[model samples]
Target chain A: MKILVPVKQAALVEDDFELRDDGRDVDPDFVDLQLNEWDDYSLETALQLKESHDGIEVVAVTVGDDDAEDALRTCLAKGADRAIRVWDDELGDADPVVIARVLAAVAQRETPDLVLAGTQSSDLGFSATGVAMATFMGWPHAAVVVALDYSPGAATATVERELEGGLRQRLEIDCPAVLTIQLGINTPRYASLRGIKQARSLPVEELTPEDLGLEAQDVGEQACGARVRKMYLPEKGQAEMIEGTPAQQAERIAAIVKEVMGG
Target chain B: MGADRALESGKAVMGGETVEPQTLIGRLLARPDAYAAAGLLAAHPDFADHRLLRMALPDRATGLVFAGMRFSPACLLEELGGWQDSAVQRRLAGNPATPAPVIARLLDNSSADPDVGPRLAAHVRTPTDALPGLVADGRLATRVAAAGHPGAGHGLLLELAGRGEMPVLRVLSARADLSTALLARIWERGDRHVQAELLRAATCPRQLLAAAAHAPHALWRRRAAGHPALPEPVRWRLLRDSDARVRAAVAEAPTTPVELLHRFQADPAQRVRIALARRQDLPPSWLDSLARQPGAWLQRWVARNPCCPRQMLERLAQSAAAEVRRAVSRNPATSAFMLARLAADADPWVRAGAAGRADLYPSVLARLADDTEVDVLGAVAANPSTPAERLAGLAMHDDRDVRRAVAQNPAASAAVLAPLATDPYPLNRFVVSQRDALSLATLEALAGDPEPRIRFIAWKRLGALAASH
Candidate 1:
C-alpha cells in the first residue's frame, strides 16, 4: 500500500510584524517558515500506517518554492520514503483549489492507495484542499478525520470524523479515498538524530507544473476561487480592569455576565 | 574590466539602446558567465532587487555576492541558509533579517561549517528549537551562547542546568525570564556561583531566597540577605548569621526592617556597622554615631553616605586619611564649601572625587579640569556639569579612560561623540556605541568599527531603528 501526504511549509509570523509593500500579505522577514502543525499529524498518520502494514510506502509532496524543500526534508527525516516538491513562478500564493489541482495531478501519477493532507494549513486556513483534490480525482473523501481503521487494499475503511461541539460521526469510506487528517489523530514523533543523518543523504525530487502535466491557467491565479484584496489585523479586544473590594468586583463581573448572556 | 564586458553584453541584449541603470545592472547580472556576473554585482553594491539576485543563484560566484548584501530578503536569506557553500551559510547565520526558522535549519545542518554553529547560537533570531542542537555541539562558547539565548525555553534551560558546566550555568543563571519553578530547579543543581547569581536576579523566588538564607555557605546567605524577595523571618535570621559578611549584607539591604538597623549598629563586626553606614537612607542620628566611631574605615563610609550630617561631613573632611577626605568629597550632603576645599587639596585623587560630583561649582570644575593628572581630568570629563567645549577637548585626551569618560559624559553631544567614535581605544568607541541616543552617522561609523562586538552592537541598534520605522 502507498500513502501520499501533501504538506505545506507554513509561515509562522512573529508577535510584532509588518505587511508587505503591497499590503496583501505579511512581510516575510517577520515570518518563520516551518512544517505546518496539521501536516505533522497527517504525515505521522501515514508513517504510523506504514509501520503496521507490509510493503507500505509513504511519499510526501509539497506545492511550494525552493525553500519549501526544508519541509520535505523534515518529512523525509520522519520516515517518509520519498519527497517531491513542485514549483512554478506563476503559482505564487496559489489558492486552495489551485493547490488541490496540482496535488491531484501528482496523485494521479503516483496512484497511491490513500491520500492524506492536513485539514487546513496554519498560515491560510481555507480547509478545502484535500476534498478539492478528491473531487479532481473522482474519489471518496472525508474531512476532519480523527481516527481511521483500515487494512491494506481493503474495499471499505472505518473512519471517525470530528464535528462541531466535540461530536464525532462514524463512516465507511471506499478504498483509495482522500482524508484530511485533524489534530489529535495521533501524536507525531520528532525526527531522531539518526533519522536526520540519513535524511541528509536522501534526495528530494523536484518538479514543475509542466512535469505534472499542469498548464498555467490550470494552477495559476486564473484558477484561484479567491484573491486576497488586503490583509490587516483585527482590532484587539480590550480587557476591562475591575477595581474595588473582591465582593464588589465579583458583583460587577456577575452583572456584566448577566447582561452579556441576556439573563 | 568584467563589468565593462558585462555592460557591453547587457546593451547587446537590450537592443543596443541605453536602458535605466537598474535595468542595465539586472541584465548584466543575468549574464551566462558566472565570474562576469559576480564582478558586475560586486561593482554595484547597492543593487538590491532580491528577486533578480535570487535568479542569479545558479552561479556559485553569486553566493559570495548574496552572502554580504544586507538587503537580501528573508526568503533569499532562508534559501541561502541551505546553500552548499559554508561561507554563504555563515554570512546568513549573522544576517539580522535571517528568520528564526532559517537559523534553526542552519543549526541542524551545522556540520557544514565549524563557525556556523557558534554564529547561529549567537544570532538574536535563533529560535528555541535550535538550542538543544547547539548544546549538543559540545563547544563551550556555543553552549554559552545557547544558554544566553532569549528563545531558550524552560526545558532547554533545565537540560543546561543539569549539565553543571560553570560557564553554561553562569549564563543560564543570569536569564531573568526563567520561571520561578525552573529557577528553583536550577538552584537545586547546587553550583555556588549559580546560586549566588540566582540570588542576585531580581526575579529569584521567595522560597529560593529563603532556602539560600539557610544554606550553610555564608556567601549564599549573604547574597540571599540582599535579595528583595527574602521573607521577614529569613531577613531576621540572616541579620544574626554567624558570618559577619551575611549580617553586613543584611545591614545594607533596603528591605531590612527599621528595627533590624538598631541591632547592626551594636553588632561586633565593624563591616556590619560600615554596611549600615553605607545605606543612603541611614538616619542622621545613626550617621553621626557611626561617624563618631574610631576607625577611619567606618568613618569614611559614613562620610560617603548622602545622609551623613553636615557637621559629621565637615569633621570627616579634615580626617588625616586622604581616603576619608576623598570620601567626604563624594558625599552629596558635603556643602559646596567643603567640595571647593577638597577640590584644592594637595592630593589629586581627593580633587578627582570632588571633580566627579554633579553639584561641584563650575569655577571649581574649570579649575580641576586643568589638573595635569589624568584621574582628575577623567573625573572632570565625566562630570555632567562640565562644559561641552571642555568635554570635546577631553575626548581627544592622551589617556583612554579620560576619553572614555568624555564619551560617558551625559552632556557630551553629537559633535563631541563623533570624534570619539574613531578614538584610538576600542573601549572609547565601545562607550560611544553604548550611548542611548546616537546619530545615524555615528552608528554607521561604529557599525564598521574594528571590534566585531562593537560592530555587532551598532548593527543591532541600526536593525532596531529600521524595524521601528
Candidate 2:
C-alpha cells in the first residue's frame, strides 16, 4: 500500500515587516519559510498508517520551487519512503487550482492507494487543493477528516468527517480516495537523530512539469482560478479607552452597548 | 540548490571566471575547508572587502573559523567584519585575534546584532574607543559586560552607574578595580542584591558591612548578618533582627561569637535553632545538645548531617517520626547494622528509603524484595545490588509499577527483561525497547509491535545496529 502526501513551505511574516517593492506581498527579507503547520499533521497521519502495517510506502510530493524541497526533506526525515519535487520557472504565483492540476498529474502516474493533504495551507487558506486534485483525477475525496481507519489494500476505508458546530459524520470511502487531514488528528513526532542523518543521503527525486505530463499552459497563472489584485496590511480597527471609577466606567459601557443596539 | 545556482549564474553573467574581485572572491571562498578559503582570500587582498566578504559568508562556519584563527592575517579578519548573521559577527567580536578596528566596526553594527555588543564589550582587546557605544547599547547584558570590563575607567563606570539598572550596578560593585569613592557612590543607590555583592568582597569597608547589618530591609540584614567583616557590635544588633531568617543567618555564621551561638540555641524562633543545628562545623557539644531537644525537626537535620555524632544517628534511627527515621536511613554516616534495622522499619516509606541506598547489604535488599507494600518493593526492584533471582521475582510482581521499576534497573539481566517486552503496559514495552542488550529475536519482534511510538524507536535502533556492522 502507498500513501502520497502533498506538502508546501509556508512563508511567515515577521514583526515590523515591509511590503515588497511591487506591493503585492511581504518582502522576502522579512519572511522566514517553514513547513506548513497543517502538512506536518497530514504527513504524520500517513507515517502512522505506514508504521502500523507491513510493506506500506509513503511518498511525499510537492509542486513548488527549490526552496519547497525543504518541506519534502522534512517529510523524508519523519519516515516517508520517497520524495518527489515538481517545479518549473513558469509556475510562479500559480493559484491553488494550478497547483492541484500539477499534483493530479503526479498522482496519475504514481496511482497511490490513498492521498492525504492539509485541509488548508497556512499562507493562503484556500482549502481547495485537495478537493480540486480529486476533482481533476475523478476520484472520491473527503475534507476535514479527523479520524481514519483503513487496512492496506482494503476495498474501502472508514473516516469521520468533522462538521459545523462540533458535529461529526462517519462515512465509508472507496479505495484510492483523497482525504484532507485536519489538525489534532494525531500528535506528530520530531525527526529523530538517526532519521535526520539518513534523510541527508536519501535521494529527493526532482521533476519538471513535463516529466509529469503537464504543459506550460496547464500549470501557470493562465490556468489560475483566481488572481490576487493587490495585497496590503488591513487598516487596524480603532478602540476607545474609558477612564473613570467603577460606576462611571460601567455607565459608559452601558451607553455604548445601548447605542450599538440602536436604543 | 537555488543558492548554488545563483552562484553559478553570477559566474555565467561574468562571461568567464574573470579577475573581477566579485567573481574571484566568490569562487575562492566556495572552498569547503575554512583554511583553504581564508588562505585563498588572504593571498588575493584585492578580492577582500567587508562588503564582498559579507555577501560571501552566509555559510557562517567558515567565517567563524577564520575569525578566531590566531595566525590569520589581520587584514582578512578585519575584512570579515559584521556578517549579516549575528553568530558570525559575535565570533568576530569575541576573537582576541580580531583587530581593534574590526571590533569597533562590529560595535557600530550592534543594532543589527545585539549579541555582538556584549561580546565586544567583554573582549579583553577591545579598545576604549568602543566602550561608549557598548555602554549605551539597549541590551542590559551589553551594558553590564561593559561595566565589568577591566579597562573601563572610573569615568566610564560612573556613566554606566548613571544608568542605574541594578544588574549593571551589581557588576560594577564586584569590580576589583573600583575605587573607594566610586564604591561609596554605588552603595548609596544599590539595592539588596548589589549590597550583597559588596558584602561578599573581602575588601568591602567595615563601615559598609556595619551599615548593611542594620539596613531596613530584612533580606539585606540577612545577607549582612553573614558578612565576615561585620563589626562585633553590629553582629549583636543583627541577632535582634525581628525577621527569623535574619537571626537564622546570624546563627549559621562561623564568625558568630560563641556566646551568641549559645544564646541562639535557646532562640525563640525554631528556624534559628534549626539553622544552628544543621551547621556542619557546630562543636560536638552543640550538636549533642540540639539532638537532645524534644522535637524531631532539629534532630532530623542533625541526623542528615554527615558530621552528626554517631551516637546521635543511633538515637535518630529509633525516632518516632518516620521522616526522622528515613533521614537517618539515607545518611552516609549511618552504619551497616543501622541500615539493616531501617530496612525492617515499620513505616513502608522509611523501609523504601533504606531500600534505595547504594550501600545497603545485598542480604537486606533481598529481604526488602519481599516487602508487601509496592513502594518498598519498587525501591527494591531498582536497587543495584538486589539479587538477580529476587529481581526476577519482582519483575513478575502483581503491580505494574514494580515491573516498570524492574525494567528500568540496569542490573536486570536480559533474561529478566525478555518477558517485559510483551508486558501489558506500553510504557514497560517501551522501556524494554530502550535496553542495550536485547536479543535480535526480541528487537525484531518489537520492530513490528502494535504501538507506533515503540516501533519507531525499535526500528531506529535496528537501523543504527545495521549501520554499525
Candidate 3:
C-alpha cells in the first residue's frame, strides 16, 4: 500500500489568524511555525494504519520554500521512511487553485494509491483547495474525516466528517484519490529522541516544478487572486460601564435589552 | 501549522520514553489530582488539556461542551430540558457528596433559605446589588480578594461570586433581578496588576473610586453610581493608559472640566478627540480650534457644529481632506457661491456634500444630481430642494443607495415614491412607507415588514397619521 502525505511547515499555520491586518498574504518571516494541526492527525492515522497492514510504505511530500526541508524532516521524525521536497522557483502569489494544481502535478509521478492533506490550510482558511484539487483530477473527494476505516486491498476507505450545527455524516470513497483529514482523527505522537537521530539520515529528495513538468505561473502569489488594500486598526467606541448589585444590575440590563429589542 | 511545527522544533524525551496510548493513559491516571486539575483546566480555552481530560470524564459530561467542566449555571438552565441527565442540576439540587464546595454552596434549592444570596457571591468580589447570589456564589469576590484569603484561587468560585450577571440569576436567584460586573479584563499582566485591582474593586458595588464615577472623561468615570473617587495620583496615572478605550474614557467626561478636557485633547487617540467633540457643551471656539486638526473625526465635529468660524470653514473647504471640505460645504450656512464652487470639486465626497445641501444653487444641485459619483447623485436625490420631477427621475437611479436616498427625501412625491414602494432595499421600501402621502393601506402593509426597525418606524408614522385623523 502506498500513501502520499503532504507535509508543510508549521510557521505558516500560526500566522493564519484574523488579526485585523491589511496583508492578505502570509509573511514568511512572521510565520510562527508549528506542525499543521490536521496534518499531524493524518500522519499519525497513516502510521497506525501502516503498522496494522504489512508491506505499507508512507511517502512524505512537501511543497514550500528552503526552510520547508525543516518541516519535511518533521514527517521523517514521526516515522515516515522517505521524503520529497518540490522546489519551486517563485511561488509567491499563488492562490488555492494554483497550489492544488502544483500539488496534483507533484503527486502524479509516484501514482500513490492514497493522497492525504489537512482539510483546510489554517493560514489561508482555504477549505476549497482540496476539493478543487480532487476536481482537477476527477476523483472522489472527502473532507473533514474525523475517523477512517481503510481497506488496502480493496482500495476503499470510509470516513466521518463533522458539520456545523452539531451534525456528523460519513462518506465512503474509492482510493487513488484525495482525502483531507480533520484534526482529532488521532493523537499525533511526539517524535522521540531516537526518532530524531534516525530522521537526519533519512533520504529526502528535492524536485522542482520543472522536474514535475509544471510551469512557473502554475503556483505562487500572483496566481493568488486577492490583494491587501490597507492594514489599519479597527475603529471603536467607549466601553459602557454597568453598575448596581447583581440583582438590580440584571434587571437594568434586562430592561435596557428589552427597550433595545423594542419588546 | 499546529503540531506540524512542533514536529520540526525537535522531538521530545516522550518526556519519559513511552509513546503507547496505554502508557499515556497510565501516566494520566497515575496522578489522581491531575485528573481533577484536568477537569478544572478543561474549561479554559487557553489550554487544550480539556480533550485529554475528556478521556477520563466518565459517561456523563464527557467530550467537548467547549464551556469546560463547570458549566455556566445560566447555560445549564437553558438546557435544563432534562435535569436527570445533568450532573450540574443534581449538584445544585443539594447533593452533599459533590466534591466542589461551589456545587454544594450553589445547591440551597430550599425555597425558605434566607442565606442563599450571600452564599452565592463567588462570581465577583463585591455584591453590586442584593442579588449577590445572582452575581456570585458567596460574599463579593472582592472581600475574598481583599482578605488575600489562602483559598482565593479555588478557581472561579471568586470569579463567579463577583460576576453581576448570568448563571447565578438563572439558577440561583429565586427572586427578582441580577447584578453583574461587565468590567471584564481585556488586558491583564499579573495577579498584582492595577487593572486586576481596579476591576476587582469595581465588581464590589460597595467600593468606589471617586474619579471612576465622575471623572471629566465620560468614559472613565463610569463605575457604580455615587462611588468614591480614585486617589488624585491614581487618576492622573491612568492618563498613561495604553488602551484608547480606557484613555478615551478619561478624556470625554462632563466632569473633566475644561482644563482636563484640553489636556486630553492632545491624546494620541483620534477616537478620544471625536468622543470629546460629541460633548455638545464644548465651546464653539474650541470646536473651531480643533477643526484644523487633520482627521476624519475632527471633520465630523466641524459638520455638527454650525457655529465654526467662516475663516475655519473656508480653510477647511480648501483643506486637502475631502471629508473636512465635505463637512464645510454640507453646512447649510455656507454661501451658495461656496456650494457652487465645491459642487464642481474634483473629489466625489465634496460634490456629494454640495449635492446634499438644500440651500445650494439650483444649478449646482442639478449638476450634482447628475455628477459622476454614484454617492454624489444619491446626495442630490436626498436634497429637499430638488424638484419632485428630479426626485422622480432619480428615484429609479440604478445605485441602491442613491435611489433609497431619493425615496427618503421629504419632498419626494407619493407618485415618485410609489414606484419605489417595492424596492429590493428595505430603506427604499421603508422610506416610501414613511411618506405622509402613503395611504393607510401601504403603511399597514409595511407594519408587517420583516425588518423590525422598519416596522417600528411604520407603527410610529401610522400612530401620527391616526392622531391627525
Error of 3 at B177 (Å): 8.7
Order of models, best DockQ first: 2, 3, 1
lDDT of 3 by residue, A88-193 (tens): 6576445567767777776778777887888876655777667777887777888888888887767678888889997989887887778888888887775643
- Position A43, candidate 1: lDDT: 98
- How close to the true structure is residue B400 of candidate 1, measured as C-alpha lDDT? 79
Please, what are the lDDT tens digits per residue for candidate 1 over residues A60-122? 999999889989988998899999999998889688889999999999999999999999999
Off by over 4 Å in 1: A1-263, B1-104, B111-124, B129-149, B154-215, B388-469
Candidate 2 residue runs with Cα over 4 Å from true position = A5-45, A89-203, A207-263, B1-79, B82-91, B94-119, B128-145, B162-171, B174-177, B189-204, B244-278, B283-304, B309-469
| lDDT (Cα, 0-100) at A101 in candidate 1 | 94
Candidate 3 Cα outliers beyond 4 Å, as residue runs: A1-263, B1-207, B210-247, B264-304, B331-337, B361-363, B422-427, B430-436, B439-469
What does the lDDT read for residue A96 in candidate 2? 89
- Pairs that collide in candidate 2 are none
Q: Could you tell me which 10 consecutive residues in candidate 1 chain A have the lowest summed lDDT? A: A189-198
Question: For candidate 3, lDDT tens digit of each residue in B390-458?
Answer: 888898777788888877787766566766755656667766765665544455455555444455454
Error of 1 at A41 (Å): 68
* TM of each candidate vs. truth: 0.45, 0.53, 0.36
Predicted candidate 1 versus true structure: per-residue lDDT over B1-469, tens digit per residue: 1112111111222123333445434444554433223232333334344544455466544554455456544545666767776666777786776777777777778876677787788778877776777767778878888888888778887877777787777888888787776677777774777788889878887877888877877778988888887889898888778999998888877887666688777788998998888787777888888887788898888888877778888888889888899999988888888899999999989999999998988899999989999999999999999998999899888787899999998788777788887775667888888786566667667755645457546544544443232
CA-only RMSD, every prediction: 26.3, 13.7, 25.2
